[model samples]
Every structure is written in structure tokens, then in C-alpha cells.
Target: MHTPYFSDRPAAARSAAYRTLWRWHFYAALFVMPFLTVLAVTGTLYCFQPQIDPLLYPGRLLVAPATTPRLSEDDLLARAEAAVPPGSRPAAAAVGSDPERSAEFVFRYPDGRQHSVYLNPYTGEMLGTLSVEQRFMQRVRMIHRKLLLGKPGELLMELAACWTLVMVGTGIALWWPRGALTWRGTLWPRLDWRGRAFWKSVHAVMGIWLAAGAVAFILTGLPWSGSWGEQFKSLATRANLGSPPGVWGGSTRQSTIPGRQLARPANHAQHGDAVAGGRGMDGMPPMVMDDLPLPSTPWAVGATTVPGSGPAGGSAAALPLDRILDIVRANGIPRGYDVAFPSTPSGVYTVSYFPPDPKREHVLHIDQYSGEVLEEIGYDDYGAVSRLVSYGTSLHMGRYFGLANQLVCALISLGLAGMAITGFVMWWKRRPQKALGAPARLPTPVTMRRWKIGLAALGMVFPLMGGTMLLVWALDSLALKRRAMR
Candidate 1:
């Protein structure tokens, strides 16, 4: 007389439950493997940007350390403008604090293209011209974001990110150690084993070890996605998560210069009245520069209407760029900050400061006419969400703790690639000839109920993933019904 608990479900039923989970895991991996590989490679390379960038553009990015007084902002701007193609004008400048770094001047032409001219501030000598698109890291970034396909590619990546979470969840379920499996096989791969068993152990172990970082990579990157990202941003903004409306004072809704336009250094401003505004790489909204022919600042400056510099040449004849620079220096803006000159008579001069340590980020919009500080915002001014995202983004970019940050992130990326490879190898070897190699479907009624509940919960948490699963289920159901009729 066997006990009821001992015989419940039998051995075959337990095995079938595992197979069902394995099938879903395989499907999730099928959707996410390639993307994981791409992201791994790109992310690893991006992690080393601080080191790789100088190597890639040595002549343009690096300059010999000099002790002589640096050239004036006006003189350097003049030299940088002369280095660009005819008809191009300076839009913004990136002032490098280190004596060995070159000051970079950004120019925009009529065709909406942006380019950068590097100049040695000490000698007023032009370094080189580089298109933002032509930069190696920019290319890598584009590939990482959407395979360089723009919106459609972005959607694919976002979908992959979502499914990757599913893959990890299902993978964890399969990896749960039970029965005979102990630390030896669970925590570390059984290298002594051969063929499919060895691959399986390796894949499982890798997935377990790297799942946390992979999830972090996906979560941090989601803020940059197009659809869900934008919606989430809207919600976060509405809730005042981290972004306060007036922290960086300026009109948030004004149409500003498109990033693409700023990419071409040779393109002239086609629309004279177009406001130059948009969020920079740092994810902060920019202040717009009203009709003034001001140089381009970081995307953080966005679109801002520089208030009138007191009635042109009136009693408040706007102080020259020199005076504005002096005021900024006196007011505690460190040496690396940039001063964007005003183009129109009424346009105000804007000073921006962003250091590697994001906690020091600040920006000041000064009225060119009266030399008054219109608005100033610092890291402390950011709301809860903004502060969190700001520091997280910086860390994600490997800019926080220097080389150690880059190395850790790079290792995580490499680990992700290893898992992808191991997983693919396991599947390829186990798959039957000319078949998908999916585990046979033999889910019992109880098991099906469990799956339904689990899926419902997942759907509620991630609508995109749930919606895709539902669509697939519907398609499969329709196909099966049609086959029965036939």
C-alpha cells in the first residue's frame, strides 16, 4: 500500500512539468539571444570609452600640456569657425579644463549638419574636424540602441529587453536546484561531464551568476527606449519623480534644434527662427536659445528664449562675452564650464557646467543685456527621480568610479555574451534534425492552471510582454482550429 503523497503526479508528470517550463525558456531565449549578443559586445566596448576615445581620435581630442595663458574665448571661437567649411557658424563650445585637452567648438551649417572643430586654447591653433556621426563611439551607441535602424530597431531592442526578463525568470525556475543536484552542479558547471550535459550545466550556472547584471543593463537602458521609455518618462514627470518643472528654469515645450541637425557641423541653420532646444546625452531638458545666432550647447540646454539683453546698446548694453566669462568665473563656475555667446542683439549668454561627477552639474542662463543671472540650477535642485536617474546613467556609462567602473561593467557585458553562446550551443546540440527541438508539450490540467496564473501575473506587470504572449497564443489557437477543420 503506497502512500498518497508518494504517488501524487508520478515520475512522468513531474518530468512533463519541467519540459513545459523548458519550452517557454527556449522560446524566450529564441527571441532574445541575438539581441543579447549584440548588446553584450557593444556594451563592453562602450564601457571602455574613456580609454578608447582618446585612442580613436588622438590628434583631435588630446593636446600637449601648456603653461602659457590660454587664448580668449573669442579668439578660440574665431579660429574654430575659420577651420570649418564656408558659411558654417559656431553654435556652442565644450571647454576642457585639463591643460592637455583641446577646446571643442561646435558649428552648424544651413543643411542642419553639425561638426566640431578642436582648438588648442593656449596657442589658438586648430586641432581637427570630426563629425559626430563619424565618431566611433557614436556609431557603437547607434548600433546598441537599435542596430542603427532608428525607431523600428529601437522597438525590436525594447521587445528583446522585455523578453529577456522573461527568459531570466523562466531560466531561474529551471535552474532551481532540487533532488540530487547540490552546490557542485548548481553553483559551478560540471566540467568533467561531456557532450550536452556539460553545456547544460555551464549555461545554467552562467545564467544564474549573470542574471542580476543583465537585468540591470536592461532596466537602466529602458529609460532610453522610444515607446515604453517615453511613456514612463511622462508618468515619472507627472508624478514629479525626479524632475521638477522649474529646477532648470526655461520653457520646456518650445521647439528646439534637432540632435540630427546638430550632428552636421557644416549645415547652416535653414530656419532662422527655429529655436535650438532638446535634452542632451545626460537626459536633462535643454534651455532654448531664442532667435539669437548663439552657438550650440549640450542637449541639456534644450530650447530656451534668452530674455532680452537690456535694450541692445542702452544703459544696460549687454556686457561682452569677456565680461560674461568673468562673471561666471567669479560666481563659482569651475574652469571646465562652457559659455555660449549670444547671436541676436537681445539674445542672452548661457553658461553651462557638467563634470564627470554628475553631482556637480549646474547651468546658468545670464541676461546678455543687463548682465543679470536669470536662472541657475545645480544638482541639489533636481527632484528625487532625476537625481537617481542622473547618477545611475553616469554609472551605467562607466563614468562614476573611473577605470574600476568600466572594468566591472565590461566584465558583466562579456559574461552576458558567454551565456548567450553557451545557451545556443546547448540548444543546437540537443535539437533533433529539421525540428525546433522544443520539448514535447505534455502539460497536465493542474500544470496548465498554474501556468495560466503565472502568465496572468506577468501580463499585469509587463503589458508588452503579456500582449505579445497573448498574440502568439491567439495565432497558435487559430492555426490549430484551421488544421482541425481541414
Candidate 2:
């Protein structure tokens, strides 16, 4: 098999390899194309969520242009406390940076559900209440990340993404320059040709051109996958290759006294006397804010436990929210930043800033009692992996360079969709009506061995993809053997 089969029969060996690569590529696209289409469509929309949300939810987002000084924080809180549902309590107040934007107060129910109440800061009028998941952008994000199926959906998307990398690799190999360069038909499609031949050339040419962008999109997004992402993040942290040393003083772990768990004034639960505090409005458990289920966040500081309040009542002893706002602005944290008010008397106020330029990302935890900056993290403070993720995510969302970034991403998405459609058409035209249209397996031991080695290598890098490939291989072998027996 090794002697004359490959040496003297080099032409035959190359032909077999081409067929094998084509078969694998076809199988990969069968699984990957649907996901690629969904990701592209959803990602493009999410990239423009900033613009879309304002237009879609103007009543809940925008306010009458501010003509006077906004109401004081205490006054706004008092109004919000009065506005929440009888059984719900305010968890956090999101102070909007724009004068024309409404302030959002998140209310948590005893069952762990949360909703946002938007109020006009200047007029002290309630704008609207929206469940976080019901928001359009959040829905788009859920479909993009988990298909709304949580962990299982996340794993499926991750597998598709990993296989997409394989598809790109096999695609490049299939169309790679074999001999002399032919600019007319190879680099550029032969528009003069007619029918399937013309479409084939076009598909191959465009696929080759977009392969790099497709790979970038896949790799950048992998850091967000549930299993692989968590494992990779842990590995980076353990190796001291994560965010800059002592950035959060190793406070990335889940907070013991979560800020989101703090109860509102109407249903206040003293920091130390939870048992003594009354139960939720009716017979339900006390309401506490749950950690946000957001898909991605730029801030490297995960969760910094808010310290307990000072000697005085949790109210008067805590620093004013307006003062913390001033500190953030003074530190050059610009507008559009969000200030999450402390959930508990001891909980620190969190000022999070995600700007157009990724490098300017920052999250500051301010002590609620003394008003001291407890934990401050910025883009510059991120470790190698975190920095990569920040930049990748920013670029992926097309927030890096404004319109140009959006345009480039949009074109890539459109191009990807076009390729998927064109590839399917080409396959349909070539396939027999009664057959599955899969490429016939190479009968030679040498060729099969080569294919197995290639698959094994890819499997090592992306275990999920490898698992799927093995499943497909097993099914194919069984079918083929059964057919032979018949």
C-alpha cells in the first residue's frame, strides 16, 4: 500500500485525497451552514442593538429633553420604590448618563425574576416596565448564544463553531493553488462560463476570499462558549496569564453577599438580621437581585462583594449616589456609563463603563459606607487572554471603529449567507434524486488511513467536533457494511 500505491501512483493518491477532503467538507457544511447563517444574522443585528433599541423602545428608553436639573437620587429612588409591583422590591438603580435617557430601576421578585422600570429622571414620571428577557436585544442575544436552551444549546452552538473552523480548513485545502496560477478562473470567477460550472467557480472563489473572516468570527466567539470558555478562562487564570495580577485581588469568584440580593427600602432586610426581616410581600420569599444573565461584559472585575453598612442606619451612613457619579466623571469615565446602586447597605456601588473604544473599558466598585474605590479594573489592567477577549468581542460586535466596522461585518455576514446558499444549490444540482449525494468512501487502506489521521488531528483540537465526526463515521460504516451484505 505504501510503496507503488503512493510513489508511482502519486496521481491516484492525490485524486483520492481531493475526494476525501470534499466529502468531509460537505459533511461539515451540512452541520455548520445553518448555525453560520443564524450567527451571522443575529450577530449583525446585535452589533447594531445600540441604534436599534432606541428606535424600537423609544417610550421606555428616551425621555423629554432635559430642560431642568434632574431629580435628586434619593427622590428618584423614593419614586421608583413606590412604582414597583406590590410583591417586588427594587434591587438596583441604573443611572443613565444621557440627559435625554430615562433612569432604569431593576425590581426583583421573591421567585428570582427581575424586571426594569424606566422613569423620567427630570419629570419623576414612570416611563415603562420591561422584563429583561423580553427586551428585543436580549432575545437576539439568547438565540445567538444558546438558542434559548441554556447549556445544551450553548454546547450545540460551540460544536457548530468548532466544526466551522474545520470547514474553513478543508475549504482552503480544496481550492488551494495546485499548479500555475490562473487569475482568470481561479482567483476570479469565470463570468463567461455558463450554468453549474459558472456557479461552482463563483462559490469556490468567494468561499476562499471569505474564509479568513469566517475563521476570525469563529475564533473570536469561542471564548464565550460555556464549557470551552470556562475551561480556557480557568487555565488562563491559573497560569497567571489572565487579567493583570492583583487587579481585583482575586475577587473574580462569585460574591458571598451578592449586591443583586439586596432588598429595597420598602422591603428592607437589615444586613445582619435576614431572619428577623419580614418575608416577601404576601407569603413568598424575600426578593433579591440575581446576577445578570448577560451574554458578554467588557469589565474584567467579575463580582466584588459589597461591604456592610457603617454604624448608623444603612441609609444615612452610606455615601450619596450623586457623589460616586461625580467621582466617576472626575476620573474621566465618560457618559453612557452605567451606575448600579448598591443592593445592600454594605454593598458597594458599581460604576461600569463600556465605551466605543475597547481600551477605555472600566469597572469601579465604590465602598457604600466610606465612598472609597474598593476594586477598580480597566482594559489596560487585563491579562493577555482577557485583553484578547475584550478586543475580539469588541470587533465581533462591530463596536471598534464605528460605521466602517459595522459595514465590514455586515459584508462578511452577507457574504457568508450567500456562500451557504450557493453551496447548497451546487450540491443539489449534482446529487442524484434517490441518493444522499455524499462522496463515495475511498476503498484503499492507504487513503482511509490518511483520512483517519487527519480526522484524529482535528478531533484533538476540538473534542466536540471530533465526537460528531466519529458518530458520522460510525453511521456511515454501518450503512455501507449493511449495503455490502445485502
Candidate 3:
């Protein structure tokens, strides 16, 4: 049943707007179809990210049985560093999350060499080393995020996201019930005839589910990409990651750390011991304010050293990695707490913050007990909207399970693929009804008989798309008007 509003209107008037939006939806579909297919196929292949993350780092997620005294963080770091040699400083030091687990580390070595080393953190024992970069999950993520083209690839993906967002809105409008929501009509199709309604049911049901996820992911992903990068950045600033209007661009304090900053996290790469004194755990002095660094740059470098956040001072006091590790242990985080070691004394111990996902993994800063986050330029102060936005991002990217999350996202990519297919087929079937062939369609008329002019008006709101639509409308409309005038 169609909505009563449209039904009440005379056929001529009703069809004008109904058909106009429909045609615009059709055109939008045509523009996005091919890319949707690419996304589908690539996304389907990406579902196995979980299976691949471990192949890159072995004996870590699950440790092999060993019967030696557990190594101290210092010793394990020392061994990992020595293993790397001086020219190639280790970037991160990761131990197993479990106390009884394996001592493994993803060492982002200099020259861009990354190796997942299996060690006896106690004995500095070298069990094995694998490449984190070459993992299947990594490859899958590459395609999903950018389809392998890096910068250009990301741009294309963002444009696709914007188009996808538009499609979702248009699709919802198109699917709106003619009247009151119905059981058989709104949800499942009537079981009477098992024909077009069955597939329509499938598409509609799926579309409804897709609407929420699609909108969420598209909006969240928009900020991370280049097309809407500036706009997205603005959103982040509003969300408190940046300064107020008229304020200068965010400085070190105003910025959020871009990636993980584990101080002694088990999964960290080797030579990541900014907190582990020069000596191994046995002889190292208790870490003090001077011993640990302050907050610093959030980006991860092949060997790039992040600048410090300066000296620490305030209401919170008592700086100690051992205490943080103890608390993690006390909280059942276990003997080997995966802590984000302070890059700066101001920097607190951050736990499990892999990028693209700010939540999912637990993050705690061993503040001067200033009792606030030390890693983020702006920490713990996120408002409710900000927190919700952060959670949405994690769920969208499937980062809750690390590699497994990657795989789930890869699978979601397939759903997008299906949407693209169904969406395209629907579009291909409708292109012949009406074509906007002239420039007059760029800016809609105040009183328009057909919805096409309204669509033309909407197109003008987006600078680039509006310009393109105006050009197409002019050319196509001119030819039509000429033919009609003739």
C-alpha cells in the first residue's frame, strides 16, 4: 500500500514528484554501480582476516608451553633490541596478554622492517619471528580501506561512501510504505504469491538492516578519508579533538594520539621500551617522573621518534609502570599486562589502542594519578556524543577482535557487494523512463510540475555533483527541449 498522501493526490501531480525522485535515484545508481561491484568482490575475499592476523605473529596470541622462569620486561626488551642491531631500532614490544602465555613481540624494525618475534620474555629466548606486514589480514584491510591504490584508492572509496549514503537515503524514500506500516507489507512480504515479492522481501529486509549500518559506517568512515577529510576533521574538532572556532589548528596538546602507544604491551614491537630502563627488569630502578617520558606525538613511525608532551605536574602523583602493571594484574589483567608504555612522562600507560578503532580494547593511562589519560592530546574528557561516535567507529571497523574483527568487516564488505548488485540491477531496469538533458535542471524552479527540477535543485547543494548534474542536465535538457520545440 502506498502512502495516503501520494494516493490522495491526483495521478498527474503524484506521479510528477514520485517519478522525479525515482529517476534521480536511478541516475545515482548508474553512477555508483561499477564501484559497488568492485567493492563486493574485494570485500568477499576479505572475510578471512582473522585467519591471517596470527600467521603474521606466531606463539603470541597462543603461547607454546615453556618451563623457564618468566623474563622481566627489561630483559625481554634487551634481547629484542640486540636481535635488531643498532641501525634498526625496535619500535614496539609486545608480550602475551596472559601471564602464562608466550612472549612474542611485533618489532617494527628500522628501514620499515617489521617482524613478529616469539621470545621467552624471561630468557630472551628467540622462538620464532614472522612478518606482521605480510599477513593476509593486512592485505585484506588494505583493499577494504583503499582497494590497494593508497591515496587515490582512498579518494575513490570516500566518493563511493558519499554516493552510498545518498543511495541509502533515496532507497529509504523509495521503499517508504504507501500507507501505515504493515506486517506483511512493511516487514516480510505477503506469502500469497511467491514471485517478485519474495525477492523484494529479501531486498527490502536486507535494505532496512543495511540502512543503519551503511549510514553509520559511511558517516564514520567519511572523516578518515580525503574527500570529506576536512569536513570530517571539523566534526572531530567539534567532538573535542580540536580547538574551538577562531582557535589555531590543533597543536600537540590539542591532538589525539593517532595510534597505539603501549609502554610495555606484550603485543608491542621490540625496542619499544621507552619505559624499561637501560637495564633489564632485574636491575632497573623504579620508574620515576624523570625516568618515564611525558606525553608526545601519537603517530607510529618505522623508526620515527615521537616528540615528548613535556614534564608532568598536577593533582595526580606517583608515576610507576610496575604499579600500573600491578593494577592490571590485580584486575585480573594478569601477570604480563599489555600496557601502552608512556612515550613521555606526561604520557600515561595506554592499553590496546590500535587505530581506526579507539574503543573495544581497554585503555588506561597511569596518570600522575592526575587520574586522566596521558596519551591523547585530549583525553578522558570526551563528551557523550564523542564516546558514542568512538564506539560507532569501533563496531563499524570490526576492531573489537583485532584480526577477527578484520575478517568480520571483510564479510560486511560482501553485504555491501550484494547491495551494490541489487542496487545496480534495479537502476539498469529504469534508466529509459525520463532523462534530464539540459542545463535548466541545475537550479530547480520555484514551482515545478515534475520532480526532476527538484532533483536538479538538490544537486546544486553539493558543489561538484551539482556542477556535474547541471552540465548533464543542460546538454540533455537542451536536446529534449529542442526536439519538443521542433
Alpha-carbon local distance difference test for all models: 0.69, 0.70, 0.50
> How do the residues 308-377 of candidate 3 rate in per-residue lDDT, one tens digit apiece?
3334456544444445555555443333224445443434454433343443223334453443443332
Over the stretch 1-486, how does candidate 2's per-residue lDDT look in tens digits?
Answer: 123223445676667777778888988999989988888898889888878989999999898886689888777877877887676655556655677788877777556576788888888898888887678888999999988899998999999899987788788777765544354557798788887888888889999889889989887888778767755655665576665564223432222221223233332222322211324253332322123222234634442222333344534666666787777877778767666655555455666777767788887767776776766778777788888878887888898999889888888988998899988888888888898798876665344565577779978867777888889878878987987799
Model 3: ten consecutive residues of lowest lDDT: 295-304
Ten residues in sequence with the least summed lDDT for candidate 2:
285-294
Model 1 misplaced regions, further than 4 Å = 1-13, 245-324, 337-352, 446-462, 476-486
Q: Sorted by lDDT, highest first, which candidate order results?
A: 2, 1, 3
- 451 in model 3: Cα distance from truth in Å? 8.6
Question: Which of 2 and 3 is ahead in lDDT?
Answer: 2
Which run of 10 residues does model 1 get worst, by summed lDDT? 260-269
Kindly indicate the candidate among 1 and 2 with the higher TM-score: 2
lDDT per residue, candidate 1, 140-218, as tens digits?
Answer: 9889989999889988888888888878988887887766676566889899999989999999998899889888877
Model 1: per-residue Cα lDDT at residue 482 = 76
* Runs off by more than 4 Å, candidate 3: 33-52, 55-61, 65-69, 82-86, 99-102, 108-110, 120-127, 179-183, 189-201, 227-230, 235-252, 255-379, 399-414, 424-486
RMSD of each: 6.4, 6.2, 9.9
The C-alpha TM-scores of every prediction are 0.82, 0.83, 0.63
Which numbered prediction scores highest in TM-score against the true structure? 2
